[model samples]
Target: MKILPEISRTLSEYLLIPGLTTEDCTPDTVDLGTALVRHRIGEESGVRIATPLVSAIMQAVSSPELAVALAQVGGLAFIHQNQPVEEQAADVRAVKRHKAGFRTIEVTVGPDTPLGEVARQLSATEQGVAVVTRSGDTEGAFLGIISLDDFHLERHGAHESAGSRMRGRAGLVTAPVTASLSEANELIWEHHLDVLPVLDGDRVASLVLKRDYQAHKTYHRASVDGEKRLRVGAGINSRDFKDRVPALVEAGADVLCLDSSDGYSVYQAKTLEFVRETYGDAVSVGAGNVVDGRAFRYLADAGAAFVKVGIGGGAICTTRAQKGIGRGQASALLDVVEARDAYARETGVHVPLCCDGGLLNDSHMAMALAMGADFIMLGRYFARLDESPSPKVQIDGQWYKEYWGEGSQRAQNAARYGQGGRMVFEEGVDGFVPYAGSLYDNVERTRAKLTSTMISCGSTNLRDFHRDAVLVPVSAESFKQTGAEVQLRRPTADH
Candidate 1:
């Protein structure tokens, strides 16, 4: 039997002390509004994310709960496209239900609703503005929005008649409504206006306003999924690209994840180029899934905000095995590291790297961040939650949970991954993955473990964690100790 160290033993006896502790770790509570302005993404961006964490947009994973929870924590979530557009819209609505420390909500008012009445209602409700709806949702019609500030801009308070200011263009802010929040913020700053309207295919559906929109857009914050921070964004798909692009810009997504698998595909490349040509460098867009730096050079040169890294690291993914394509994750990250540095010097554009997969546990997560990934995308880690679509089931007597990949045939064919992945039969699965009560518990636990790991590594904050961590290859003995703590714990029973 191996001898255990005494409780009195000093840490230096076994591990090196960067002299770090939980106290040294910084809490990720930076105000998103301030970060945006600091980052220059937008000052009048309606949606603001405080943290850089973004939920993966895979249908089997992201949900309304995911959106709301991540938003609450100051990160943003991309509602996956696998679900019906209506469902995706509902998820977006759910995010608004809980404030992400922002000032506005993207609510719709009937087109027939009189402008004067709309202004009065906004004054009464104190919501500041409304995205005027012309037809059904997702139509991309821009009409106008009634802003109380704009209403007050042209007139005095209650003493001055609301009618004078409510008449004609004074009460309405029109639009192709297609400006990015950064553009809108600049317009608002330059023109001194309060509200900008967004048009759907047939009507105005939303308004971004000065008081309600985040003042600055470029600040990055720690993400909800991992250490990489996220700004605001809507994950878009092929079908809604044109219509939703403006909406995403208005919603305050700083970086767009382009939402494609093959970054090298002509369609994806063109889409990236189109966004750049149309918006210029007003917003940052990320494209992905090309294993080499060749694709990175093109996207970065095309003004991609960031580049996605990884091919088959998702839990349910079999891309490498199925497609016979993909470089190993560690190898890929190393390549991107070189690419990011070289590209930054040559182009003067610093594109942060997000390692998209191959992270299996906390150690792997630490390794990814340390190995130069600006952030890591976790699928299985976020799966198997109460918010996920899969309901609990009983299999063999042992309890287990469900997880999957976005590329799995079962997921795509059945559309099961959008709400939840395909449920595998595991005995006592319910008992195994009991609700675990609240997700907050899980988040807290994960954070604590991550923090402790950082302490062990002699680092504080994600930046330091990556910059200073020491990576020694693990030995057989260390691997065997994986379940030592669990093995030591025994259930107590009554006679």
Candidate 2:
């Protein structure tokens, strides 16, 4: 049995101190933005990740759809390495190919296709721009694109079916695929076309929508690569990263992270070097799950783009119980952060650090960031969300989602590693979390909580929270008094 840390000291021992009181400061003014551990998201870009979940796990943990969604909101999802490299690469492709931007080819309707079929196709794809083409291809020819405005007008005015209206390219404005973004934007602006389909000899190439083009041009918050696809990250274990990193980079992973639970080793270091040497400055590599100042320094010396902290901190983790190893999360994060500062001062390379696991609520997350994590990596918290690979299950009238840690034997099997399963000694557990809605909803709510907490603490931005925020120990009773401690009712049934 292990002695409780509270026997020596409790979490109530340290409390965060706030910033200077200001009436003008509001949560809206606060920006929780950060960068990929390499300090940049792209080739010469200042686009910062607003709230990232860096390297949570490989494909067994995160899905491509979730990755794309996170990137759209200015954060990244690490495509997990549990799947075959090609499948993982395909997920990356799907994320990079998602359209929250300029589209050259979208939904297409044939000139002779029935209006009912056209309506169904548009509804299914949620396609705003419907290009009318001969031979049923929105891809074929410089045929006229349908204007929703004119379609609606004709629908209400002349009572024309889609087939009749789409019979010719007369009313549509077309552009050659060779046109530059500026030229395309100009064409759309000049003609007031809502959707312009680029044509390759009458075949549709790319659908360029005006609003998306404007957002791509104006929104600084959107993280995009040189090709304009959102930036993304991938996780690879030290044992196999040398083989995986090359394929991952070619498949458009903007950053690479060593997903080892413990990374202070010669093998991990050598692989880190290989990635650094091969990719050069093209990709940033993150590594670790180090629990102390010494390990943090070691990783910094070995060129980790960012380091991970916490060992027995994850919700389902059993490392401490089984091996009698690991430190309390709070102590580990604070000490490692101090080491990060010292290393930065000595080497002039400020390697960003992420706090992995041990988070149970928004308040814990808030305190963690206040304690100096560049970002928080969540497992079970994310697992319960709608986007995770877990399927929702109904149990006793409550909804739940499956959650498993990478060290769990179930996770090994889930990854289809047969002999790998024999080696895993169950350092982690397979379990379930209460079904939370979508990741987007959960993250927004979490952001709101952070904003409220930061505002109450009198801090304006993340930097202020890091620099001016202070923690003062509180008594156990005092900690309870500070929160929702009053027990009024007992009956509960999913909120």
Candidate 3:
């Protein structure tokens, strides 16, 4: 028995816990928006967006229903992939859509177009972004990009054309006469420039103007992705019930995302009721990919915990082009806001609302939050990764991943609809998707980018992003100047 002296702190000494200095122990006061958004779904989840920021769901890559899974973690998904209308509708029925701030409206533009011309186009349409392409073909490689404000000076005849201005400049000013999105914003306000152009390589590829960008940038939000008790979700096609939903729940799915192209169908309504009755509130229900709030109301009446709002707003989605049946994201967001508020007031349940699409970047997310959404869903952004069903492979000596519709004929037939006309869903039923790898990296990187945007507005959290921000349209030159031609600085997470 080695007798070691027993050492113990006295009661009084024990009172002094390490790391407990309390000259002022009170916590700093946080606003409602920040307070509500400070929680996470599970311990492993990262910081919440405070505003719902989600990616779009296009079958060309990922399904809209898959977007709901991301939303459970405080993101949005757009379901406008190139699937058939019925199949697309079925995908929308697969997840819960919550109304919250945060959006990103993805758009595209050609590479050959002059920056000045692109700026004018954006100005005329009041569109915020333009995804620049190197070729005239849709599948063409990416080229340099631009924002509307990049062309502000050039459009205003600051030095005739951008070429002339750059040529006229002497010394260090010889570089492209454009700014990144952040710098362009500063220039737009400080110099009161209109449009900002995003440059790619040396030429202007796209543009973002003060007014148009701001139009979707401004809004207010209380909280995003901060639900406490039950997870509200829904299923799209009956076939997903056994397969996808069970797996999602086992992985921490609380809400059921019931989505569809049209929310007014009997099939959707019955599906909503069936989910509510079958799940018996074990999971809170959410439904719809409806543009206006009508579908939201229907789903709510059918025991939906949340409603998804959106018609057609997604990158890689040809819905608008294919069907020409959809509402603009801005208008749809407002409509859902009205419906959600009114419904909440009418019913004591206070079910949340979710914006389903029309988001391109951090600013769009802020705008959606300001418009009063509880959550946002994402799709295309989250795809192209390992977790996605697609398989990644080297094609044509380039990194490429397979993307397809979950409700396509191939999918529907494979699902094996029974004699009762209902599809059977079970685990392992998730269709084939290419391996993109490390969604954590993609999501985290995007989050960092969004945080930088928030910081630019002097906001520490997504809450402040909504409260303290301004949006304004711009002229063509300004748009061009704010484009990729200028270096868009990536922000550090700590920033």
TM-scores vs. true structure, each candidate: 0.60, 0.79, 0.47
- Give candidate 1's TM-score: 0.60
Give the Cα RMSD of candidate 1.
Answer: 12.3
- Regions more than 4 Å wrong, model 3: 1-234, 238-253, 278-280, 407-437, 456-470, 473-478, 484-495
Q: Is candidate 1 or candidate 3 better by lDDT?
A: 1
True lDDT of residue 75, candidate 2: 68
Local lDDT at 378 for model 3: 60
Per residue, candidate 1 scores C-alpha lDDT tens digits across 97-168 of 332122233444555555466566666655665654344133534444434654543345444433333323
TM-score of candidate 2 to 2 decimals: 0.79
Top lDDT model = 2
Candidate 2 structure quality by residue, lDDT tens digits, 232-267: 778876666766887888888877777766777777
The candidate scoring highest on TM-score is 2
lDDT, residue 114, candidate 1 = 50
Expressed as tens digits, the lDDT of each residue in 26-133 for candidate 3 is 212222122111112222222223335444334443444345344434444444423344454455444322223122223445545555665665576455545455
Model 1, global lDDT:
0.52
Overall local distance difference test of candidate 3: 0.47
